[model samples]
Target: MDKNELIQKYFEKSLSPEEAAMFENLLADKEFADEVAFQKKIKKVITHEERATLKDKLRTFENQKTSTDKWWYAAASVFVLLGTAIWFMGQKPDYDTLYASYYETYPNVIAPVVRNNNDTITDTEKAFAYYEKQDYNKALEIFQTIIRTSPQEEYAQFYSAISYMELAKFSEASKILSGTNWSKKYADDAIWYLALLELKTDNPDASRKFLLEASKTSRYQKESLELLKKLD
Candidate 1:
């Protein structure tokens, strides 16, 4: 088959075993891989544009004159919800797929790395710089040291859990995140990541429970709701 045919089948996810092998080989070519990445970005842009257009039309419809419009607006809202449910129903992904979809590394918000001429950065700041650079092993080492010295440092503990998660040390991450006495600032993050960890570990029931709790208060409220729909 031609490369175009392989790419089309890939996007449709209908590749036969032989076509799948061909697709994998094609990905080894830089030009083919760039084409795939470009297609992905184009698809994302189109999806966002379509969603924005739908929302704009819905807003316009709701702003139409009179109490009579309320009934139509209500019907339209129900139709949108049912359509979303049907879409999710057809896209029931496995736990690993769902985890990959939702898991992003937690950012280094606690300490923004500031460059200076002198070598005067603190351990916490240095650790966060490593974390931002995706050097999880070194970051975990420093964070563990900080926790040992000041056990009450919740921010250090929080980032340590993140580092563990990055290293796929799920048990260690779970232990720290599930511990009591997280500060209010990191409590919601811990809950949300615990949900992702459970999903990664293939415990969907536990993941659902944590996601439900996170939906109540985390910054991931919309994501939690959407993931719950997928689980359903």
Candidate 2:
């Protein structure tokens, strides 16, 4: 059978055992595979168009009817379309879109240490201002300086990791997030950022795993569950 016939039979779901076998064999060919995929997409478009047309006709009929009775038809159409839209969303959730929807910049809360009794602002203070203003390049430089001076400061470490993320250095960000010396105070934030970094790095399995583990803790449980629902 030709590709068109096989596609039609497949859509109709009435292919005989022998014909179905032949159709499967044809799908192995790139041209045939492309045709089938194109046909499926076109079918989806046509189905939506036809549904909209039917809805318009129903609306027109409802307009012609008495005002009290017309509401039933309108309500029915709304419910049907709503159900279809929800089904479509479930059938094709874009992971990248979902990630963006859930992701937000981590807020900075730590103030720079006082260098002296005078009113002089230090490099760490400048870095905090830059970070607050979203000046990531300057923040990264100042953060590096602070890390050098006080390598044990967990707040500086976490913010420096976020600076790396803002500068698109995800591997560096992951390294800081995976650091053992960070106190438990930053543990939840670290896990969340690690999950986000994994997603950015195109490692969905690792991202899912991180999210699952983080979900056990209350801090990110709600968000992790929502993201996991989309992933599943």
Candidate 3:
């Protein structure tokens, strides 16, 4: 397939292993490098914009909470009384309810491509597959194991941060991504994610700062530019 077809298939996650290998090899070719760069930029901007819009809507809901009707408060009070009664009667708060609540609060992050040399590729691939399928808990288990086994693996670190982000664990994601020991490839990605996390948390200033730093590097220049434009 041609370069554009290869890129389209890659974005669709439909490329065969051989096709993927060929695409990776083409990253070295200067002529088609611009196309790859553009794709990454577009992906970042689209994801960031979608998430930012959600954040704005969430903020609006939070701001308008005080204006909710009396019936809403009455319903909440009834629920709370029922919950307290259940607690007093020694019945556990339902595990399924808790799990569902947690899932609602924290969505899963997109999984990263795992490297074969630093850890067990099969396990990493399994975790990534689970993440892709939106089975966040299983993916988190594998990511935690990878970090425990190889704390210095930047690929694992990056993905771990993403997992936290997906779960809306912004503070945890920020903490992991803020570290200085990441590989160049992972570091670039981390910076971009960090900027998005800041934006999600309503700290546009910090987001802009992180984006500015990311814009200096060729790897993230296009995305950073697009994000900066949005902030303006």
lDDT of 3 at 97: 36
By TM-score, the better pick of 1 and 3 is 1
**Order of candidate numbers by TM-score, starting with the best:** 1, 2, 3
Q: For candidate 2, write residues 1-232 as lDDT tens digits.
A: 5555566678779999999999989889997888677556545755676578777878786878798878887778778877876787668457667767877888766663444567888776788889989999899888888889988766778888988988888888988888646567988888888888887777766776677667768899888766755554
Q: Write the per-residue lDDT of candidate 3 for residues 50-91, one digit (tens) a residue.
A: 668655655655566675554575456557656864575575
Candidate-wise lDDT, in order: 0.81, 0.77, 0.68
Clashes found in each candidate (C-alpha, N, C closer than 3 A): 0, 0, 2
TM-score of 1: 0.59
In terms of lDDT, the best-performing candidate is 1
- In model 2, the runs with Cα more than 4 Å from the true position are 1-93, 112-117
